[model samples]
Target: MMELQKASNGIFHDAAVEGGIPPEEEKFLQHKDDGSKRPEFTDFEGKTSFGMSVFNLSNAIMGSGILGLSYAMSNTGIVLFLILLTCIACLSCYSIHLLLRSAGVIGIRAYEQLGLRAFGQPGKILAAIVITLHNIGAMSSYLFIVKYELPLVIQAFLGLTSASEDWFMNGNYLIIIVTICIILPLATMKHLGYLGYTSGFSLSCMVFFLSAVIYKKFNISCPLETYGNHSVSTVTSDDTCTPKYFTVNQETAYTIPILAFAFVCHPEVLPIYTELRNPTKRRMQNIGNVSILGMFTMYFFTAIFGYLTFFGYTEAELLHTYSKVNPLDKLILCVRLAVLVAVTLTVPVVLFPIRRALLQLLFPGKSFHWVRHIAIAVCLLFAVNLLVIFVPNIRDIFGISGATTAPTLIFILPGLFYIRIVPKTQEPMSSRPKIQAACFSALGFIFMIMSLTFIGIDWMSGEMRSLGGH
Candidate 1:
């Protein structure tokens, strides 16, 4: 098996660079064109600056996945969760480094193009499939947040009772209204670079969310000591909050994959790279590093504060936890609105890569068409809305999407492409780069296997619980 794998690697390496400039010389060439015509409808050389690019990429990295961190911490506890999150962030940075380096050496901007260069048709198709799955799942998660959280925000603002049956209070009706009003218009934009302002606003909203979590951590009283005290309100029990530092169990397997999913911005990486001003490996690497570092800090604080606030009782969606704890808290309500706006703006950013992947797969060599772009965007939003309406369990979607697609895109593909494109002549098989690539690929494979196993176990347990309930 090892001999066959080695032979396969050599074949891919040889085929990947057959017509391209040599690896060492490729980086030195001023312009390494792929000989493809530029799209007439969309300008490839966008004027996105270093700071704006960081904001856009940071927005992409931090999405609905952040909402589940408290729940993830509930499983792994504070210490292990932090350690795992740090390791995943490091791996994510390294994977982006490999991608940027490979793309720079080859002068290929699009992810599908990189895949084509690395492993031919199959590689291109695989990239498209993963991008499609991952982005669709991401968009669905954003819409899921909208569908569930939006109604409560409305109710809190209006002082509507749970018994209210008004059409305006209906979650389905509200999601549809918001989708048409907000998401559709944004998703129709041609270039991602134009959405930089919206991305920045979305990121700011998330900052407010983290702030609210931190404030509530100290303000909200714990309910444990007054569990059976009829006179004490759970929301204002006056009990001191206690935070767990470390714990582990079968559920720890699930936490890693969730953290892995939280950092997945790979599909958007190449697109952002293509648009970056003064595009180069080093500049793009800096963009990725700054963005990941910012997000890493945000995720760490959000998870720590949120977990500290709720400890053992953190729900899968932190917003839901907040709503259940204190529906009338003005600050919590504002946090909900901020998150709603953030996720609503984020749908389009996530949508761009999926649309690009579809165009690359189905309309290869064709220039961007407005009709096709609008049609694809509409169809994708429609599909995502349907899933959000029907799929009540966000964690299940998060698990499946993270387990199946996140690792492949974040770790496996980038590592393999780095090894394939950089020839042994340039970076020997026993070199540091190859060793790191091997370790990265191994990590991805391990995460992939563990995620799948955990998903299967959860599914069976859920079914048994359902059967017993019946």
Candidate 2:
């Protein structure tokens, strides 16, 4: 059985077949200079294990989104949030099924190519644009973390007060420095396959982060609030620690988008599938399911513990709230460093997709060039750093990207691709699969409009308050 599996999936040059051409090398098949020439699937093999694939996919799922979930939980209440979360997770898993099914019928593994195969140039362009925007948002949010936490981490390490007026204390300047010194160099590397292993390490860091949040919940007292310069704790008998089961407000609209943003791992699914040894649909689907489930547990615990720690006082970025306990505390400081390192290292990997999407958009049918690669990375970092420096809050990034980009990738594109790519002979238009695909795409549109309306209302409310104050 092992030998047969190896012969089929391993490197072969005889003919185009499953498991031979990796998604990455799909570039070779793109060369179309001669009309009579048929593209060949280059000989390639994948060595990613089921366990490593799960970790990598989960690493993709869990990101800057976790930091804001407690705030989401705060607005939506515990019960409603869990219900929403469970539904979203399941929908995301189903979305992966749609993608795999689409890719299987036609041996197109790249997301944009699936789009192209499904609906021609427009579809491919749409997929590229959505992936670009989604990844740009991801990179911006990761840098946003750098902007928010790095300065604080620096101050803590130096044992400086919040009043310290040093240039290193400024987040804007520090983000620029870090981008040049760390993120840019890493992003310029030729091959990022080695960086895949960092996913496991990054996952471990978040686990440590979860552990710390849980520890603080029990070890720290209630009514913890930061005054002008110090933390003040007042234990009162009447202070309630009860969790809210349901909540409503303008801010509640951000919850779904945030959840969507957190679960936007669909882009990584096909590439991982192409890299699996046996590469069965069920095998890859199981990997995705386990990855999403693992992340779901971690996110729920982090939000719950962080929310319980501060309750109504929970901020959009969960890590920021911790400094109130003591920015200089040894444990908190270490967690900050771990998070900072994980995100910084991740910036390069995250940047890889965005650059690839840009290549498909701008330089199609062209071979690799160092100039394009380096220019995109530099330009991306420059633009993202500006966004991090100028953006008012990370929540805005989560809300906007989740509403628009997340749904496009997670729901709309997959559904449309499945409907178009899968043959009518295999599944009629009236079949359950096709019906579900249509409904799923429609749901994405509905989610977009609903989220936008609520966010617009929230914005108007804030504007009115400002005008009234003036």
Clash count for each candidate, listed in order shown? 0, 0
lDDT of each: 0.75, 0.73
Give the lowest summed-lDDT range of ten residues in model 1: 1-10
- Residue 109 in candidate 2 has what lDDT? 54
Candidate 1 to native Cα RMSD, angstroms: 8.4
The Cα error of candidate 2 at residue 222, in Å, is 2.7
TM-score of candidate 2 to 2 decimals: 0.82
Pairs clashing within candidate 2: none
How far does residue 82 in candidate 2 sit from its true spot (Å)?
1.8
Cand. 2 Cα-lDDT = 0.73
Q: What digit string (tens of lDDT, one per residue) describes model 1 on residues 19-123? A: 344443344233332334221111145467988889889989988778888878877878888898898888889999888777765555677767876887788
For residues 328-355, could you state the per-residue lDDT of candidate 2 as single tens digits? 5788888888888777776776776677
Top-scoring candidate (lDDT): 1
Which candidate ranks first by TM-score, i.e. highest?
1
